[model samples]
Target chain A: AQSVTQPDIHITVSEGASLELRCNYSYGATPYLFWYVQSPGQGLQLLLKYFSGDTLVQGIKGFEAEFKRSQSSFNLRKPSVHWSDAAEYFCAVAANSGYALNFGKGTSLLVTP
Target chain B: DVKVTQSSRYLVKRTREKVFLECVQDMDHENMFWYRQDPGLGLRLIYFSYDVKMKEKGDIPEGYSVSREKKERFSLILESASTNQTSMYLCASRRQGTTNEKLFFGSGTQLSVL
Candidate 1:
């Protein structure tokens, strides 16, 4: 079975400040990791994903995440956040070659201008 | 670009009524999925179809059923609408054998049961 854990339930950051959201996973084999963002009344949008190769992956909207195999973590980071960055973010994981993803409870980000 | 569209953006249904949520994808993807999003539960998969007329139950499929009569369409059915079933339902699609492929999602349908 695959599972994803996001420790932070909520995070607040000032606009133009750096931000980091933590995520961890439990899977038997090499996992396929993903980050998704959801705005109010909107469906989830893929932020970034990690399958193989590079340990760091860049996503849309100036977001990026580092995949650390030893830590079992794939944390999302942004150099600077904007007011529009406020939304619910989810970290998901799936087993190698498996299509279904197990998602974390989610972390709600509040950006203050 | 992959375009996934849902039938309704907002819906209101009475308790005990059967509700159907429709989803269509233009990418001709072989895999389609239905999930419900709650306040703190993130997204829980309700059902998925990998081919026409083939359905698979996901983690939470107790009160929901699915139909896929065509490759481009997938429908989610709530046997009987209930207050507890009110949620934001999301539909997603992905191509088969593309294990690393990202899912494309619809805007979502917010269903309210009265």
Candidate 2:
């Protein structure tokens, strides 16, 4: 079965500091990887996605993710963290022909000023 | 812009009552999905519709059913609402084609079964 794993349950980062959220996936073949962020009481918004080429994909809100095939990972990174960046982040994977996405447990990021 | 709209932002109901959650999309997407969001569990798929009148069970679909009578409308129904059914229900839509496309989500409906 395909699965996504977000190791960190909660992470605290100071504002203006760099941040990295780790994600690992288990799939049979090359998968469609995605990172989604959700604010309090709001639906999820797509952060970035990795499908075919370009291991490094930049998404909205100045976020980027690197898809590492060998490690089966797609980690999200930000050079500078803002106070508004505090939210729940989820890593998801879908098979090439699959319709539904398999999401991880999610990581809650808390930004301190 | 693609807009997926959920009927309600918040709802409260009594246990054993029948519940209905409606979703509509303006993008004319062929795929619509329902998911329940919880604190630690993340987002769990409840049901998805590929086309009109075509519904498929997702990861967690036991207490829910779906109806897609039109291309832009997808309705999620709970036969008998229970306290455990209280959750944040999200509606999403995506165009048909490859799996690489991102899904457009609604603001979500927070349902409380008391």
Candidate 3:
């Protein structure tokens, strides 16, 4: 079974500051990686995903993630974050070509004005 | 745009009561999934259906069952609601035969079993 580990449970940053949420996965082989965001009282939305090709993947809302095979990580990064970006972020993986996705516990992001 | 709609936004059920969670997709997706989200637990897949009348158990299917009698609708049933089942239930749908496709999710139903 593949599992995603998000070391940070919660993170706070000032608006316009750079942000990075760490994510690590445990899988024997390359797996489908994804980053999802959930706003208050809303469903989870896809931010980005990485399957193959370039190691660096760009996503919506000025966010990006790099799939580092050596480090077993797919860390999401944003050079500057907006107050609207304050939400719960999750890292998910679909292993063994399965449709079922395994998600991390999630990291709650807080942005200060 | 694809839209997944769950029947309820919030539900309150008593213990030992039978519960049904309905999900419908506007798009003719071939796959639908049921998941439960708990604080500090993210989301756990309960069941998924690939086609009408085809259902598969996901990671946490021990306490839940699913029905897919129609292509665009999938239903999750809790035989006996328990306090432990209190959580946000989410429904998602995806196009079949595509690995790169993302799942379209509903707003989710916050179910509370008392």
Estimated TM-score for each candidate: 0.95, 0.96, 0.97
Please write out the lDDT profile of model 1 over residues A1-113, one tens digit for every residue. Answer: 78999999999999999999999999766799999998876668889999999999999999999999889999999999999999999999878664777789999999998
The sequence of per-residue lDDT tens digits that candidate 2 reaches over residues A49-110 is 99899899999999999999899999999999999999999999988754778889899999
Candidate 1 per-residue C-alpha lDDT over B22-83 given as tens digits, one digit per residue, 9 for 90 to 100? 99999988989998988889888899887899898999999889999999999999999889
- The CAPRI classification for model 2 reads as medium
Which residue runs of candidate 2 sit more than 4 Å off their true CA positions? none
Q: How do the candidates rank by DockQ, highest first?
A: 2, 3, 1
Candidate 3, residues B1-114, lDDT tens digits: the string is 668999999999999999999999989988889989999999988999888999999889977888899898999999999999999999998888654668889999999999
Task: After the best TM-score superposition of candidate 3, give how far the Cα of residue B113 lies from its true spot, in angstroms.
Answer: 0.9
Q: Point out the worst 10-residue segment of candidate 2 chain A by lDDT.
A: A94-103
* Residue-level lDDT tens digits of model 3 in A6-110: 999999999999999999999989999999999987778999999889999999999999999999999999999999999999999988454678889999999
Query: In order, what lDDT does every prediction score?
Result: 0.91, 0.92, 0.92
Between the candidate structures 1 and 2, which one is better when assessed by lDDT? 2
- Give the per-residue lDDT of model 2 (tens digit) for B1-114: 779999999999999999999999999889889999888999999999888999999899998999999999999999999999999999988888757988899999999999
Q: Rank the candidates by lDDT, best first.
A: 3, 2, 1
